[model samples]
Target: MKIKSLSLAIISATALLSGAVQAYETGDIIVRGGLASVNPDVDSGNIYAGGVEQADQRVDVNNDTQMGLSLTYMVQDNIGIELLAATPFSHNLQGKGGLAGLNDFAEVKHLPPTLTVQYYPMDNSSAFQPYVGVGLNYTIFFSEKFINGADATFGSLELDDSLGLAAQVGFDYEIAENWSLNAAVWYMDIDTTGTFKNANGTGDYKIDVSLDPWVYMAGVAYRF
Candidate 1:
């Protein structure tokens, strides 16, 4: 009877210690926020010549900075889901050449909300966590402004609403118990249509533009 009692006590103690270790290993909720920069390659096609030519027009977009916040829930040690929110980014557009020279520079707004499924393959003992996510983006354009020295206002430039696909890959390295350093890169494919009308309304033109942007971000994350 004494041996049996000792054995049971040992088993109970071992189970409690095991449970404590597991509780420490699994994180229930994580919150991380950071800043990102948007670098977009803007390309447009002319529809008038029956053949699509990559326009020689050079349009420069101002480098813009944006902030993002995300919440993650760990379903298991290796898998999670994250919802991303960020501030709206505004861009100025300018071009030169052909009829392009006739159009003035304009400003537009783009907002992208992303949700991704994350996978952490090395969650057991390593401080590095790598993840990948795929999501949808809806871009809204507003508050249009035309550059000075141009003949037309933004009203003369036509742009349609867009829905796009987004994908990202990033990683986080835990620097401390509550802080982690992170870096990520994302790709977004967005398409739009713009109509340019002459000031006299005599000549109307249409343009198809693709603004596929690549985003790079590096910042610190805090877990609560």
Candidate 2:
């Protein structure tokens, strides 16, 4: 009876060691997509001399909803690289008080493509996976329009092309062997300047706006 028990213990230890070796040899790729609401903390500066309360001009921007896709390639147990893609986000701008009747409203569309390097400290665990990322983003603006009342007309709004920094914190919960749910928050520090012009005697004006936005997203990811 004693000899039988010792043989069973040796077999169990060998099986556990084999499982650990198999775990170290596995690689995973994950694809995820989600939606985010982008809220911009906007500040505008007017370049025209004697500009009417440019510093205090109340600017209105519509809240933007954006969809994004990310592809991650895990190079090791706890490190990966991700590439992110998204559609263009459009926003409307309106002047509230003194210039309300002038060329008051305009629309601008921007596309930001980002790339990140991520580190996962808990990748080897079964229940929880947390990650942090730092990256760079580039923004391009297009499709601009101006509307102000009866004298409303079309013009060019100048937005300086910008490069910015991005940061994110996120976590995932494994629900099954090949599936997980994810939630994340990201932030970008973007600075931009634009010039608004109108053909109607309203004169050409410039605005310097800062769009530092926060993004919140949740989605499911599939691993292979």
Candidate 3:
């Protein structure tokens, strides 16, 4: 009788231990912070200024890095809604291809706020979770300034705001019951028209720039 009682107690303890595994559940909130890098694959239209076409005047934008933040809420065991935010990103404009040597021709700062619905493709109790997300992105541009000869030639610069689609793939590796390490990569469709004006506002130029970029991030996440 003593031996049978001990066996039952051992099995009961094992079951309790198994139930202690932490998994994502409804109403869970996750917050993540890390570094994000934005690298643009630019395709720019020819620059037309003062009714004159500049030959091969394509543009290039340099990559920028900034602090990244993501907030997630679990609506179900495997479905999560996430919002991405970050510090303002700044990019330096340059000339590309036939219009080379126009580095730092201008600078602009912008913010991209994205909302995604994510699907996790693993059991909730698994230590590693991989997810795919599709969402919408809105980019707001401001603080545009010209540099070098471009400034003297074109006094005012502005970039049109963009509305586009965003896609992401990411994974989280569990480190503790409520802690995890995360890595993600995203592709965003960003198209903007840059307008430039003379110092006296007498003339204007327009260039359509496609700044589709790949964004990469890695950071730590905490669940509450």
Candidate 4:
């Protein structure tokens, strides 16, 4: 009877330890929240009027930071599907190249929601987990308006929505039974055409801008 009681005690202790350092398994859900920034690597095209492209006129875009959030569901031992979300990011539009003197031309808001299939290479029991993911990103641009000097010269403005591929790399360090620290970076391919109407009684003009941005995020995560 004493030997049986000792075995029971040992088993109970092992179970308690397992609970204290939780392992991510199938059906686990992780929710993370933190700060995220989007920095645009802009490649601006010449402004076009009618069928003619301008000589050297171009535009510039500035970066912004906002609260970011994400949700992940573990489908397999080392595979998870994650969705990244955030508050709308606002940026200032400026003139570049030939139009450098006309800076801060406009402001706009956008949201990028990305879905990725993440692969965790570290063992499930490991406290430090590193992951890589590839997925789709849908960026929606809105509230585009002309401002500063360009506002008086341009009547109205609109930007196109973008759908592109997104790639990510991140890690999570387990802090307790149900919480961890997380930091991630993503590269998104975003291309769009911005159209503007001239206030001087001319037709609509267009410019193709590739605002492919690198996104960085860091925060805390909780598992359920």
Error of 1 at 47 (Å): 6.4
Q: Distance (Å) between predicted and true CA of 142, model 4?
A: 0.3
Ranking by TM-score: 4, 3, 2, 1
Each prediction's Cα lDDT score?
Answer: 0.69, 0.71, 0.90, 0.92
Q: Quote the RMSD, in angstroms, for model 1.
A: 6.2
Off by over 4 Å in 3: 1-21, 50-53
Q: Where is model 1 more than 4 Å wrong at Cα?
A: 1-27, 47-60, 96-104, 151-158, 196-203
Candidate 1 lDDT (Cα, 0 to 1):
0.69
Quality of model 4 by C-alpha lDDT = 0.92
Candidate 1 has which clashing residue pairs, if any? none
Task: Output the TM-score of candidate 1.
Answer: 0.73
* Worst lDDT 10-window in candidate 2: 17-26
lDDT top scorer:
4
**What are the RMSD figures for all models against the true structure?**
6.2, 4.5, 2.5, 2.9
Cα misplacement distance, residue 221 of candidate 2 (Å):
1.1
Q: Comparing candidate 2 with candidate 4, which one achieves the higher TM-score?
A: 4
Q: Total backbone clashes of model 2?
A: 0
In candidate 1, what residue range of length 10 has the lowest lDDT sum? 17-26
Local accuracy of candidate 1 as per-residue lDDT tens digits, 156-194: 665687888888898888777657888888888878876
- Give per-residue lDDT, candidate 1, residue 115: 69
TM-score against native, each model: 0.73, 0.78, 0.91, 0.91
What's the distance in Å from true for residue 153, model 4?
Answer: 1.5
The per-prediction tally of clashing pairs is: 0, 0, 0, 0
